[model samples]
Target: MGLAVIDKSLFRFDGVRQRMGLLALLSLLQALCIVGQAHGLARGLVEIWKLHAVSTLVGPAIEFLAFYALRHFCDVAKQRISSKYGKYVAGQIRPQLQEKIFRLGPQALASRGTGSTVTMLIDGLDQVKSYIEILLPKMTDMMIISLVILVGVWWQDWVSGLILLLMYPLIIFFMVILGLAARDRSNKQYAQFNILNTKFVDSILGLPTLKMLGVDKEYEGEIYSVSERFRKRTIDVLKVAMTSTFALDWFTTLGIAIMAVFLGLRLVNGTMPLFPAMFALIMAPDYFLPVRQFGDNYHATLDGKNALHDIMSFIDSPETPQDTETKWEGWKADSELKLEGIDFAYPVGSKPAGDDTQSVASHSVAMNAVEQQRENEDDKKSDDSSESKDDSKTDSKSRRHRGRGKKDAKPIEADADGKAVAAQALTQPDALHHVSMDFKGYGKIAVIGKSGAGKSTLVNLLAGFNTPHAGSIELDGNRLENFNVAAWQRHISYIPQTPYIFSGSIADNIRFYVSDASNDDVNAAAHEAGLDEWLGELTDGLDTLIGEGNRGISGGQAQRIALARVLLDKSREVLLFDEPTAHLDIETEYDLKKTLLPIMENHLVILATHRLHWLANVDQVLVLDEGQVVESGTPKELIGAGGPLDHLIGEMGGNQIDQYLN
Candidate 1:
């Protein structure tokens, strides 16, 4: 509500304070021009009242017009200075903010919804620019121009000066009160705007899923509801802005009217001359002009102030720690990774404890409701067994409490006596904890776990997408502080369940990791990834455009493209697959595996999956439950021993060899 305090930060921006000083000087000069114009006009009018010749008034009238022109020239100069500087500052901030966002990575971006981040970068910066451009000149004028005009009026006629001066505090009092109301309302409106943006983006992204479930109309209604709420909030802010404008206008007009009445009486009684009375009357309005303008522009600055705060907060957020100085040659066939007492948890969404948190929470609830409704409709259409399986997975994931509460809920442990007992107090709720493992000269090591059993978390940690809170990782006998090192990431190819197809030609997307790859190299990689036949079908072959807004490729084709990217980049010898085939149909999955298995022969592979069939291909198996490694060994050994892997194989509908054969 106290905008003045918040707005002070604008001065700290580079060149803003210096720009303010120059604008203030210009405002002072403009104020003098204003007084000269008023004086000239008053003289012309007084001469006319005395029944003087028209020729006699020409000089004074010309003087008035000249001063009026000069005053506007100053205004233009001030605007030009402020606007260019504002744009410069905006340009500087945007890139720095973007770089910070990139450094924070996808996990951070997910925590702060994509819609909100996009809005802050685009609309938010635009608002701040507008605020800076307008605020600097207006603020300078209010401080300097008003005082100059008031002094001029006092010099012409003291009584009129006293009356006009008395009105200043009264006008400001009402402005402050209304300004505070406007600020509060505008803040709420801005927050609502963020919600509307987030919901719109989410709805658009999920439109395909909504249509499939036949609940697109329900989501549309939800969007409309959010839009309506934003509209109402906007109206509330406008009402306060309008009231402030009205108050400032009323008080200034009242003060001018009083000054006019007093000067008329003095002139009638011969206590004041015609020239002085007219001059005083003409200058009264100019005295209040700057203050009135400031009040009118108050609402415009509110958004800018809020946006600056948001941008600053994002820039200050803690980034994932990286040891930039560490040098390692690269991953190799004999390279070994030893993770000792590894622990990790998804970071919680830390919202400020005020209206911001409440607003985001409310929007989150609405979004969740929409998602829940869609899920329910999907459930109705799904088979009973599939629904039961999905429900079980959901329960398991919920127990992990990823990004849920304030503290990390440590999973209870079992003692030697097999009694359930509390584990050591953990600082945060962990997605993976005490996950010690060793991988040397990896052929194919399969990390098997149900949903919420920390499979993806472990993969993310390995790929440097996440950093462990407490752990030591030694790669190739060198003590590694964290996995997110640039040198380490360069040697890894991460293939997720759904691979991202960047907007470009087929060859370009395939050659993403190896930008310098030749056409021959791309063709060879595509052939290996099983995309050669698909490319032949296209008119442009390797050059065929794909991705958003281009030719829509099939899901199988997208996966192949991701594989092609990995294949083209020969520097990357380490492959990390996080259930790349989980979403494919059984036939498609089987076909892709035929292409995938052959490529894994020489590379060090760490594949996280729930599919039982992949176990046959993996040389070693690591079974995880509740973030801990429960059992690990060769598939034949685990099966012969009849332990955790055997039980999991039964849960996955028996041995996959029989299913494959059938």
Candidate 2:
């Protein structure tokens, strides 16, 4: 909090600059009204019978416009600040978060679910606008308002102003107490709602695998449990919020009652003038107006503060050095690449990737998804093993047993805390630990690892999504930190295992990785990635709409489109593949490898794969175990060593040896 307060003080953050400017103008108008009206009314009341009540019209006009302008200013300021600061906070936080997640690499991304992060980043960040724009500005406005209120009261009558000001400390004190109570309940409600969001995201992502396993019915139970908890907590928050409204109503009623008593006593004795006393009575309730709303709006502000808490949590999160440059004008200018001794551990209790409950739940769902995939692989392995054994030894009943095992062993893991905990491990499962290596951008290299290996993390790091914890990673020999994040992004032609598509035409997606790409360039890229064959079949060709999230495209088609995007980005000096052939059939994989190799040969091609046979044709192979590079050399050299490759090959069986050598 001390740090946060200090940071805020230093920032001069212009979240509500435009609105503040407007608010200042509005405050000036109000000040003139408050100052002018009091004198106008006083003068008119004194000389009323002499000049036909001229002060009545002038004084009322000032009062009406003063109130109107003051309220309007506050309203506009709140809205404007909310919009601007909300966007400002989102824009700054999103990329940093995405980059953080990206750094965790494929292993990290895959271990988590997507739905939660998407929902949190989209909706959760927005809820915080009340604080970033409204409460923060209002807090400042309150200070100035208090000063103005005291000054106006003093000008009218030092005695009345002193009485109001002296008594206000108690009112402010009670308000603070009310605010504290509201904040406590509101924070709990916010935390529970986030949990519910995480659970919902988990439910959605795991729906497919759950359906396959005939456990779809269970989702309702899970969702219901979360919803019930959320609903109850929301009610609790609302009850506390309403408590403030009660206090406000009471204060207004009591304040007016007190004014009546004071006026009655003063009027009977003729100790005070009629107009001044009346004006003071009217202004008494006005003193507590902001307080009334403060009590009611305090809960909203509490929500805002929680949202701010989440955002600040992200910004304050320990960051791996960021790769912010969009275009690496000239990396490796000193040397091609360099890496120092690397050692890293997950930062504990730290938001490893600044992912909220949504992202964490998404990860949980994604991990659960792995269960189905693993089951399938195990089944295939069993089938192949059974087939290789003599036909006489085969039990037809065994196939059903194998299918059941696959069903039970499904790929994705659903225990929410399981993935959350796993994601926190910097070196969980097959992550690299103390190993380090570097190379220039002129050649292709393969990073090979089986299921739990950190190949994906390594890929993300090279792709500039992450920062190394202990060792320095450099591009073109310049320290990674010194590199601009946005600029370095331009250095890679990236092709994901599962491709992404926008809700636009086929042409739009292909052109995503390139700017102002001509028809010829698009067509050329499509053929290079072998997407033209599919395009030739489409009547609309490049203009065909792909729908949101690639709704219309088959999995293979999506991968192919992604490949075409890789080709289109001629500006990128490096190409990265994360199990590019992981999903393709052998025949298709072979064809893709055949086409992909040549295009990537001239650039830096870093491939992370589990398929051993593919390495036979590659120039270099990097074998990962835990999180370290256990073995790295030419594939031939490693195969001769009878090391990690031999182990992976032995598990794959003899067919790989013969097929790969041939």
Candidate 3:
């Protein structure tokens, strides 16, 4: 809308300052050429009007042609400079964004949907590149070229200059109004675009299930509705954009027309000479050219401005500090990972002070939804309950509990059999509260909790995707601030519920972690993962292509590929599974469990699951409630002990399963 809205952060890019300066210089020189062309053309026309010989017009004609060509040459050079720099800046920003997202880990992915992240990486960067390309030269032209041309017109004739001067503010005033309108609409359009992308990607990923459930038609209709909304938003933005373009053109055209009328009247009245008057008339359009060009592209650049802000905000965002300097050997049989009084909370806000960074809100959409839902439910319960005094006391207690630091924090009161009472609701400030635990050697431990009980939060902290606000973690007696050390993570293999299978052959996917793994080793690992029969069934064996756009594999097969990767990489001595079989059928889970248990041997396996049967294979069970450890012991000690684990087992029908099996 105005120069004030232009991103000053653009100057921070390498060579941007130098390139912009060069563009300004070029624009200045080009403005001089424009004046020369106008003067020479006017002289040539006057000579022709006086019935001069063709030979007399040669000099002025030559002068006009030379300046005209030179002016356009400068224009081309400026464009090339701006465009090349735009691409260079885009190239520079892409990898920085990728690296930041990579360092942030799966927590970043969960916070930012897979669809939105991909769109930002691809389409958003492209928009920024286009914005840079169009903005720089246009800016220089408006600042330098327009001013110089205006001075030249005033030198030719003051009246025309005054008319141009009056029109400039009017044009700008209208432009600002229209630009503001367009900007608001464009923002809404961009938001709708992101929503559409997320929903589309989510639908595509779940298309198989939709088809199987015979609800594919209904889901298709939902996508159609989303697409229609996006289309309408886009059209609204386009309408504003068109209106802006028309206003710029109308005002600039009117100014040139008014100047022509005045110049013609003066010439007819014999009060003005033909040369100066004609020159002013010739230069009138050139004076308004830059402003019109900039105004025209202003709407086009709004999306880019939004995207650049998003990217810059994300890049500037605070990340959990990594202890890269810490020296630690790989995990060993006797190595122990201990946590003392750990506490964590999701970041309160995504944006830093004074910055309108969309990345935070985009990333935290799902998390905020979950938190809001919890708060709403809590409020609903409070309203429905007749025990108003008890509710008030509970609220007061929660407030007091939140005020205390983890050091001063005491464990929530426990019931009989050492099972912890329900702690504060997860909607409280902290996701994890005064949590403490220890993992030693190759012991297998399962962390069990209901949804929102901080199971994923704990795993993320252990994997170094998150940092504890209050805690001391020690590995092998080496005091550590967080588990984000590269040396430690190098030995850890994490498998989520839906392990991503990259678009490649089965062998290539298996060799992901250990790239140099041989075919024989890949085969052995695949066999170990119980994929040998499947691989044998395929004529291409391990070389058969899978993943997106290739042959589709079952969920079980994808899990097998993930296991094969871990097995092929002998260096990974720690396996972190966050419900790897949660999506699988019962029969498939049993088969995968058989393959998984053997691989879990001689490794520190931390499994977070809702499946109670896993307790039989684990060395210890930790029951978490409201972000704190409620009860923990060997499966045998807690199964019939009327503890949290036992209660959870009964609620989930695990006791019935156990009885039926026995």
Measured against the true structure, the TM-scores of the candidates, in listed sequence, are: 0.76, 0.67, 0.77
**Candidate 2, which segments miss by more than 4 Å at Cα?**
1-12, 15-25, 31-116, 150-163, 206-227, 322-345, 349-363, 366-430, 433-450, 464-491, 498-523, 526-561, 571-573, 580-604, 609-662
Task: List model 2 lDDT by residue over 245-277, tens digit each.
Answer: 776677566655665676678768988766666
Candidate 2 matches the true fold with a TM-score of 0.67
For all candidates, the clash counts are: 3, 39, 1
Q: What lDDT score belongs to each candidate, Candidate 1 first?
A: 0.74, 0.58, 0.76
What's model 1's lDDT at 225?
A: 90
Q: Whole-model lDDT, candidate 1?
A: 0.74
Per-residue lDDT over 384-457 for candidate 1, one digit per residue giving the tens place of the 0 to 100 score: 11100110122223343434432343222223211111122133355566788898885899999765467766
Clashing pairs in 3: 111-363
State in Å the error of residue 536, model 1.
11
Tens digits of per-residue lDDT, candidate 3, 246-269, equal: 888898899999999999999999
Which one wins on lDDT? 3
Candidate 3 off by > 4 Å: 36-73, 109-119, 180-239, 349-407, 410-429, 498-569, 584-598, 612-617, 636-643, 655-662
Cα displacement (Å) at residue 242, model 1? 1.9
Considering summed lDDT, which 10 consecutive residues are worst modelled in model 2? 385-394
lDDT of 3 at 344: 66
